[model samples]
Target chain A: MQTEEEFKDFILNGHLHYIPNVSIDCAIFGYHEQTLKLMLIRHRNMSSWSLPGGHIKRSETLVEAASRNVRMHTGLDNLFLQQFKTFGDPNRIQFNKFDKEKWFEITGLTSWEGNWLMDHTISVGFYAVTDFSETVLQTDISIAECAWFDIGSLPPLEFDHSEMVKEALHTMRLHLYHYPIGLNMLPEKFTLSEIHALYETLLGKKLDVSNFPKKLIALGLLNKLTEKRSIGAHRSPHLYSFDREKYTLALKEGLVLS
Target chain B: MQTEEEFKDFILNGHLHYIPNVSIDCAIFGYHEQTLKLMLIRHRNMSSWSLPGGHIKRSETLVEAASRNVRMHTGLDNLFLQQFKTFGDPNRIQFNKFDKEKWFEITGLTSWEGNWLMDHTISVGFYAVTDFSETVLQTDISIAECAWFDIGSLPPLEFDHSEMVKEALHTMRLHLYHYPIGLNMLPEKFTLSEIHALYETLLGKKLDVSNFPKKLIALGLLNKLTEKRSIGAHRSPHLYSFDREKYTLALKEGLVLS
Candidate 1:
């Protein structure tokens, strides 16, 4: 929503268009220059940061809703998205923290007891990996600010979002062994050291040099180009690029990389 | 629900106690004696079979709701449950197939257009693995029958359940590589051939003999016992058992078993 009236109407009548008590929260992981970061947003009415999320529309699929939320925040489309988990603890949201009087002024409602937005909500968690350098973070009227935080040093998030981020990172790291990634995070032709660094950064650990790349090559997800990059005297390394066909197939049908 | 009045109340006022527009569906896979099967339920008012599922109570978490549903149908508890995926296609449910007149008679409502149970629902799919031989199938007032069907010869399921089963199996097989399983499906101290058969049955394919077990042993998940099982004359096999601590730890902190 972009206006006060729109936001008010959403609070009052959004159930007609959107599914009530269900939302989609995304953990957008950004990778650039071997640095891992996460996208977090602060609502205009909230004090703490949260994963960018919105209710799923009646006409949209879950992934479509997640993709829309991700695109709205990052200004990037078609990133690799995966649903990591769903959170549905009854006490997940602290309703006592809600500013009832503040919301009543905007919504013009005396009591918000039966409001559609006040019910127990279960959020579907989706994680996406993208290159942070290419993203132009945008904020709507509801969002006060949008920024990237280092994954290792995230602020205390609101509600159950901290657990969501932990689970998202765990699932993403596990997926690194089964799915082909780094297509959008790396250059068209990159050296083994570059890809190894990407894995090390994402996995948050040091891997044996060339061991991960060898598994990718054996899986036919990577192609070792004959051309070599010139860095220094007798220091050129062979360039490698992802086999798009095999990479796409591996994404659909998973494979074990280790 | 076991009574007609309870069912009617659930149809009309379930949202008071259950979250609306969100449901939980479970694909309960049963493994026993080198055979794999799936649990399917048939509603009393429906003609086809579907995965055993129910609405999440307002007080319960997602996994708790899933566990309740699985227990209601299988007479078992504390199975290995995993949330495979959340399915939310707009057209996933065929509303036109609804027996509106029959429901109206049961609900004593003139028009059922805005009923809590008739709205667009997004289902969270969870899958659990258990030994079929131990479960006693059950059916409530709404469910006409519940039975275990062989995995290879499943009947055409209703709604998006066929797709749900496919995704559930795909995810369960992928999980076998990352998480240790077969705890409930195997004997306490069994031979390598017994565990090998369990893996093959669950994966629906052949695995390299001694290769998979070797990985498990190296990971400290399996322990070799001095005791051996003797079958025929001079033919004996070493007994092995899972290290419960390591297996539980591996289940929480996933490891690459391949």
Candidate 2:
């Protein structure tokens, strides 16, 4: 670990004694196995599971800080990122007298020993959903390992992360029915069933195949590609991709997720 | 305006107490004259115009605080209230210097002053739209009169109210484009032209008459009221109100203004 002296004269000086004490955490979700899963890391210092998050930097906007943190920890830059909620409640943070020794080691070198870091923290939350098969991530050193936990079965998280995950999943599922996700997460050309599967995974329910395509087609937010997937031998479903210009404009005016 | 003795023990004991410091402000809007209008109150102590807003009470929830503030100021209640945005720029409060002398007269009591009073003021914003014809309101004593200003021809507002109005209008415009606002704003039954006119005004544009009904029908968030309008002789138009249940459900799921 770097000495406190090495970090003191840097930007930490700008923060100096004035760290706002707030952090941003993202419930980065990836879809696979017909289930929604969240990205989490095993903290090397603490030997506990935690959501991928970091403190807000002095020079960054909150949204920018959130986006940058997601990219920095997970190596998933240019991914779907959106601030969903902000959690603020007193008495949320607690470290008993016994836990302080280990807690300080986990937080890294610190100046004061008898007190916790900062006064109170308010965390801004962001959520993103993507198909896991497409991503190649670079895990940061603080993260012992990065893995996805199924929405139904999350491990015990260090803070209010489990609640954050649940809220994010619920938010994502709620959006899946009304809004199309192909604009950011889906590949250029994907099959009808693949999109349907993604939707089913998000909604956690089966969908009627007949009217779904007709409804999507009528919106004119999708463009059918002439090509079809070669891997699936039973039937070649028409490939489709989001119409960027129209999708963006639809998003701007008011698009119901239904 | 209570005395210092009434201060809570926790509040008085701390040098840097973290009060939520949030206030609720409503951008109450009404429709009239084939144009969108906003209900604004003249600043109590100054010639400046501002949205009717107030500090939230300690015992109330945010929504309750907003609703109460609207009713207290405009004397209009039982309306659809929506929180469109939360402004927390760390610099928003420092924008306008408090009119101390004027406030002293308006409240007729002095307890808080200096840093404590300044720190006591952070705000959350809400906006509502209603048809002005159906409601009666009595203005609060602080304002000379409540006036509806055309969205375009608004006077300069005090303390970031202009931006608040802009945000609220944007939210309302998004709602008019997507969700059905029948029972919520319009009467139980209304002509297609009335609905169309409302949308046209909020959207700040014109709509193709023939095509508008089809789009509304396609959304299925609205109901066709069978009642016919007997007032004007312009080809008896149908009367309808908003479908509250579907609209509420749609909104909860991810209804966004594009």
Candidate 3:
């Protein structure tokens, strides 16, 4: 980590080389084991959590900045991402000054204990959907912890990250059925029950079991395999997978995620 | 109009109170006479026209800034507004230096002419929908003219404002039928044909006349007014208006715009 003077210089002088007063935050939503999760990071010496985010370099587009942050925090790449919203309230940065002071205290940076970190800034919010089972959380010197939290129960986050997460969820829910987002979260082949569970997790409510399957089948984006899996007590459920060509065509035509 | 010294002071000192590297642009789209249009403004002494935009103030939210810009460019209030996208390409601002320099030259500013106006800034795009017949263009000292241009035949705009307009149109189209936006652009009492014209203008295509009315009626939000409108060489069409209470209920239930 840089000393107080170096950090101050990085803010006042070096930051000009990047896009000043602008940041990008990623609300990486993942699906695994029939649950939806969001990736969050805790800065070194800070107790409050926040989404993995950083400033945009002068040479990069906003999407590239979000992609870089997702890779840096999750050790995963080529994830499906979308820009959902931009949060630009002037008070967003300074809303968590107490957290900053606590962080400074633990880090022993007395000289840097001021409003420098709480300057007015705007943040663009991007969300990524990835397979939670394949992602490995990565930590750097500045990041004390990086992990996925259950969507239903998230801890208090610094700044307006909680609001960002809420907004991302709302946008995703609005676009979920119309887009092929859930398909990317599942494996190459899965059961009907697995896809239904993913939708329930995202929508935060159990769908009508009998009606949902019929609706999904009517959409005709899936191919039922001849093989079946038999649970100990239940009847055998046939395996199914997305027909890539049909799925793409349905997505292009704005069909519901079936 | 500010003098050279005043302009310099505004740029160097006054702007410090606002977020340095973030701006807001307004793409005010209007519907009038079966046509869609966009509002554009020309800065004093600059040939290139641009959207009405300004840096976000430290005391205001992004939506407030956008609302202020819409009011500044068009003398209309309580318009239907939404934030569509953010344009953050580093080269978006300074790419049009000749116009910026022209603005500086006419303002009689020499001290702050080099790159002060060309700073790296990210612009949050907002779009407003309004009845075009009711809006009056407002021009201030810094603005040479404010005018509405037909969406189908827009003149060249400065920087990336044209791209912003295109993006806003695309978003509005996607959400058009899914939201109650067309109601805001229509009068209190209108014929079915009038509403159809507005949708056609917005969607950039003609709808199936026989099917459009049936689809709208199925939503069950409009009231049949005991009025009719007649045009030359056309049959008199019955007038209709929204049942305010039922409309609000349908809107809350996420009924497609009708």
Model 3 has how many clashing residue pairs? Answer: 0
Residue A220 alpha-carbon offset, candidate 2, angstroms: 6.9
Off by over 4 Å in 3: A1-14, A95-116, A191-193, A206-258, B1-9, B103-116, B208-239, B243-258
Q: Is the docking of candidate 1 incorrect, acceptable, medium or high quality?
A: high
Mind listing the fnat for each candidate? Answer: 0.94, 0.00, 0.69
lDDT of 3 by residue, A31-94 (tens): 8877889999987656789998888888888888898888887788877677788998867875
Q: Write the per-residue lDDT of candidate 2 for residues B1-258, one digit (tens) a residue.
A: 133333333233323443234456799887764766788877445667888876544344556777887777556776767665555444555425545555544445474443334552335678877776654655654455667777788998877778788878776655554445545456556677776776677678777773455565565655787777677667676665556676677665544332
Best prediction by TM-score = 1
Clash pairs, candidate 3, are: none
Report how far residue B7 has shifted in candidate 2, in Å. Answer: 14
TM-score of chain B of each: 0.97, 0.76, 0.83
Flag the better candidate by DockQ, 2 or 3: 3
Model 1, span A11-101: residue lDDT tens: 8999989988899999999999999999999988888899999999999999999999999998888899999999999989997766567
Docking class of 3: medium
What CAPRI class is candidate 2?
incorrect
